[model samples]
Target: MSGHSKWATIKHKKGAADAKRGQMFTKIIKEMTIAARMGGGDVEANPRLRTAVLKARAANMPKDNIERAIKKGTGELEGVNYVEMSYEGYAPGGVAILINCLTDNKNRTAADVRSMLSKSGGNLGETGSVSYLFQRKGLVTYDAEKYTEDQILERALEAGAEDVATSGDSIEVTTTPDDFESVLTGLEAAGLEHDSAEIAMIPDTYITLDNDGTRKVLRLVEHLEEHDDVQEVYTNLDIPDDYDPDAE
Candidate 1:
């Protein structure tokens, strides 16, 4: 879990940089459109849509663009009929990889994803291949400086969080998916702010790699994430303990 937490922290920091480039906004809107289309456009009735919209707002996505996405999903306007898909694979060092995508054409997306994987020394697997190695959990991350650990632990436990831990300058709260919103709401009511909150796939076990292998795994994950159709990439790679962000 700690390894997954580190990966998440790095991913979040990188995502913030991607947002500045405006490339990540496309993924956010696609997610919102798909969420709204699957469930109703009403955020109150759709937790997924609510989360997607919240992320978009946090990213400062335009209000009109958000509204237009909802409209398209609700059929108020015609839009791309995206289909949600997940691809399973392995990165370098046998690290399990799960790729989530939203696309109108499965064939094209699959081909592109497969090619990318093959070129990167990975091979797509059958459904449920590596997926079983991961469990869905709600993760909430906070900057440690924002609150005392005792305070966060008390509120989070009282609000149904299963676990809370501090890593460096960050504190992480974990909960079952069913208890996520409730815990988040409780935190909000208590005026606690989180750095990031979302339901994510946590690996059952992680594969540790040396410097070379870690770099290869990271490159493969980064490449997959850059694809326009790819939304999220989950992996079980435990980043090397000696990794120095500034050294790279």
Candidate 2:
């Protein structure tokens, strides 16, 4: 498992996502709309839409809001047309970064991302520059304290999961994109709860950084994630278990 996955688990445990519920809703809604537009409105028939709906449900988004977003995407209601864009970049310590965005204006998004990178000791890379370091996979994480590794491994492997690993307090289950939903359902049936689940860009390797360098890279990721258009940010940074993100 990537340290980034553990960092996300830490954030979830800290209620960072809950603290920004409105912002989180906004991002999920955008994802749902785009997924519906690209695929179809039927969640059962559309894998992307189904994933988006699962994310919205995880956030406790209102059912009505989810329906409305899907309607907009299916053209049943008016909605902003968003273009999907991906930006490759490098964070501090030369850690590769991949940013996925949904934006109405490409020019504005590109400029904003470039400026953020330049100001944060990073620089945007040409297409495919840093993207090659990542592989798209479905990642499902659980609290290690709540579930034993053996329990998760048994259920995950039985459900077609590719790999299962424990990092710090997180138990991460990796699956192919096609098997993601089925694995989640199987886990649920087995009464295994998940902390966070998503189709993420997993790095082939990680760059372990010292405390100070880790903070610098984390700060840069935080800044990028704060942007309205930036949906997901992936990095090869290996966050140390003892590094306190809130420390000064």
> Candidate 2, residues 1-248: lDDT per residue as tens digits?
22334544434433332326788899999999999999989999999999999999988899999999999999999999999999998987798889899999999999999998888888999999989888899989898899887999999989999888877788889899999999999999999889888898888877888877777877777787888998988888877667776776
Tell me the tens digit of each residue's lDDT in model 1 across 83-110.
9999998887788999999998999999
Model 2, global lDDT: 0.85
Once model 1 is optimally superposed onto the true structure by TM-score, how far is the C-alpha of residue 152 displaced, in angstroms? 1.5
Measured over all alpha carbons after superposition, the RMSD of each candidate to the real structure, in angstroms, is 2.5, 2.5
Model 2 lDDT-worst window of ten = 10-19
lDDT of each: 0.81, 0.85
Candidate 2 regions with alpha-carbon error over 4 angstroms: 1-19, 246-248
